[model samples]
Target: MKKKITLTGKILLGLLLGFLFGIALKQLPSGYIKDTVLLNGVLKILGSGFTSAIKMMVVPLVFVSLICGTASMGDIKKLGRIGGKTMLFYLGTTAIAVITALFLGSILKPGAGLDMSNMVSGEVTIGESKSLVDIILNIIPSNPIQSLANGEMLQVIFFALLTGIALNLVGKNAEPIKVIFESANELCMKMVNIIMLFAPYGVFGLVSSTFATVGSDAIIVLLKYILIVLLGMIIHVTVVYGGLFKLFTKQSIKPFLNKFTRVAAVTFSTASSNASVPVSLEIMEELGVGKTTRSFTIPMGATINMDGTAIMQGVAVLFIAQIYGVDLGINDMITIILTATLASIGTAGVPGVGMIMLSMVLTSVGLPLEGIGLIMGVERIIDMFRTTVNVMGDNIATLIVSNSENDLNLDLYNSKPLKKVA
Candidate 1:
């Protein structure tokens, strides 16, 4: 009998193989083979299908998880307090993430040395920027069903929270609905396991397709930008998250990091925080968080908490401004941080969503909007890294809130040794 590899092992293998295959595709002599047969055909479908599978599960999983989590919280006042803490932690961390990116990007100056004589000149399609007033109004969701159908996360989150709160208020009368959601949440989690079975294949297709289409010129040019975003994410995830776990909670971060390895692979492959919600919830519970905490933090985190995206946008503002030789004063820098942090709440978890939000950051600073095209070639690859950080942020928030509420099961978290590290 053959020995079975662990899930993490399998995912790492897939990532490695996919990376090598992508380079191989890039090395092909003519564009025809990559364009006509492999990239355009096999790789395209596999990549699209995998993302679609993850996306298909997102709405159902979020709705059920939010309902179940909210219903489980017996104390309305405690629930409200948890909500406030969650919002503070998420917003504060996002601000910190952007600040880190701004500080680092300014020092690194990734785009400062670039020759901008050959940039593609065209108006990039940036959706209209919403005023703070507009954002507040839209949160009410005039038609929640429409929001659900369109996958509008902010509105969807608003609706889910209300439904859960209402269910809790009705006492035993809403018990049946809550029970239905609990079962549905279980079913949805099972779907996450089922979908992840294809992750290796999906990773292969996603990596190969990305590299094949991007080619060499763009990769070489944007390699520095890629490295900058990656380093910033690492710093924020490590220093901010790891530091917080050690400070307020005083718990070993080993368990949190242990569970994150698997979650990271999926988030990195799919590049969508929404798609990663089910897995994050599972790991949060496994890491000893009670139902009361995990349910609310995880879903809300996915929708509005985007530290990683904010980091990217902050770094992007500096990179573009440096490339265009635009001089931004302290006021502009502050504006960039504020705008990027706020914009992160509206950004989705999908790949390249950072760039869309980055456009807003640029416009806020009077930087050239088309500077986005300069980095588009490599955004797909960087998306994988930032998303890993984003999901990590959500899990971190859950852990923090759980510890504070004394709802964490430390023994359980310490009981099971990680597969790779005990």
Candidate 2:
């Protein structure tokens, strides 16, 4: 019989087992195990290794896939159209996400009961904001090689777009370059497959460490804040995405949600949309997105589509405001929504990006930077859920856009799954 298990299933099992073990350790007095190598060394290594492996693939996969995507466009005007539409959709959804989050958070008042005196102040300082000119200038890297080396995603995207456009301009001469990039893209995906085989172990370590460190008590302490964030995420995924699908494609949400279940599970378990890109792209294709739409939209969305991050930023701002006993004016609320939406695009999609963007949101509203500390302990755990929602939002946007552009193939979408990566 063929192997029945999938990478996603294996990762889910890992997460489940790891959480069980962590809870057991927490409940039972496993002082010896805690003091011994399991807690300090083995667990940390596994978690770090998984993250490092994912990060290792990010720069190469993005650069190659982006080059492939852009070059495959064949027409620069098509690239411009797709780019414009994708950005508009992403930015619009981000704005909607933050607004919904702010609205829900205000109604719920998640921070009202929290005691501010006991909460620890965050030590990390917010960075200085750049002017629009500076932000634009920074997009063109002085050294493209250095940008990739440093994993500067925006700069890398900029460079890749330019290269792809230049290649398109070269006409037949670009064939060899396109071939090389396509091959590299295939190789990088293979690398992702190889890395994913170790996913069970990696997830076990990461989730175990995360739960052990955060403990259930922290969840109790921050229950209100957590619930509000989660509620906002659910609203965005179910309501906003659902509405978009109905409005654009006139399709039932059932099929989309069914297809999304698997991708969302992987995204939640791994907590990195960049890491989840291969799976998301695969699922999007399976859900009827054409090669062109999937290639262009999914990768770009992985880079900048951040509904989850935006919602978190908004809720976090409200949580902080409530904790500080500050009443935010209407202007303040609008400012938060705009700031979070823009920051979602501007911020890199690496780990801790939500926190960094939260700082930006707080800074825009004159909220205390120190307020971040209150939530840092739980940020890692929260990030997993937020990112799952982020990936889901991206896929939904891609589907809607594909349908709008008449690029989706409903027959292919309803077909059986693709052959699993060997």
Candidate 3:
């Protein structure tokens, strides 16, 4: 009998092969046959199509799962407590992430020996960011249907929470509606599973296309900055999150990480926390986080829990300041952490949004905005790792909150041989 390859193994194989193939493709002559036919043709279709397929499930999964999770709670106070815990954990972790990055940046000095000439000269367009008051106001959707259609996650979340609370309040009268939502939630998970069956192929296409286009020149240029940022990510996950997992849940981090590898792979490949929500929820279930906790925390985390982005912002801020010969005091570090943590709340979980938020953070500290252009060359690759860390933070938060709420199944978490999902 042959040993079977798990989904994680298959995905890893795809990533490896895709990388080698992409490097090979990069070496080929620049012509229609190589560029138009292969890179833009088949690879584009496969990568884009797979991304679209998974994204198609995000709205429905979030809306339905959140409703089911919220309505099942039965106690509004419990729901509020859960929400509070989730927010606290998210914000705390994010602040810690930034501080860690700042510390690493200060010591390792990734920006040392680099001059302004290294800056990529391009017009960096900063997105129109909203005021704190405006951000709060925007969460209340004027039109729920429009929010869903537009994938306005914060608004969608607001509406879903209200709907779920209402359904829970109606009690016996809303039983039928609750049943429908419960059924819908299961259907959505099943759909996610079906789509994920093609994950390896999707991973291959996406990775290959990205590598073929990006090449390695940018990586070589910003090697130090990239390494320090990656180091910060590793420390946050292994030390901070790991410590929380042990202290709170009293479970080994190994199992949590084992169950989460698939989710991490999906997130890394896609580089969109929103796109990885379905996989996150599925993996959360396998990790024994109850629907009530996982559903709410995961989607909310996707939108707001950006520990990964916070890490990037902190390192980049220090890097930018160092390159410009700007001395940041303790006050500046605190501001970076606070600004990045709050900014994470409204930040969308997509590629390159980190750059936008980084711009915002830099402005807060009066760092030169041109520093963003310096790191733009390597942002795509870093975004992949940043997203993986963000998703991991979400899962860890879910576990902690679920355990506190008595919603975690320790037996299920510790169980070997995870139940096979499609």
Best model per TM-score: 3
- Candidate 3 residue 238 C-alpha distance from true site, Å: 1.3
Compose the digit string of candidate 1's lDDT tens values, residues 160-210.
Answer: 888989998999999988888999989988988998888888878887777
Error of 1 at 357 (Å): 1.0
Residue 212 in candidate 2, Cα distance off native in Å: 0.7
User: Of the candidates numbered 1 and 3, which has the greater lDDT value?
Assistant: 3
- What does candidate 2's lDDT look like per residue over 1-422, in tens digits? 57788677787898899898777666655566684677778987887798788779988888887788788778888888888888998999999999999999889998998887776644756566544456677788999999999988889889988887888889897898899998998898888878878878988888887777775766788888888899998888878888887888887777767777667655665678887777677677677787667777877888788999898888889998999999999999989887777777766766677877787788888998889888887888789889988888788888887877788887776666567655
- Judged by whole-model lDDT over C-alpha atoms, candidate 2 comes out at 0.81
Q: Please, what is the TM-score per model?
A: 0.95, 0.93, 0.96
The lDDT leader among the candidates is 3
Best to worst by TM-score, what's the order? 3, 1, 2
**Residue 312 lDDT, candidate 2, scale 0-100:** 87
Model 2 C-alpha RMSD to native: 2.6
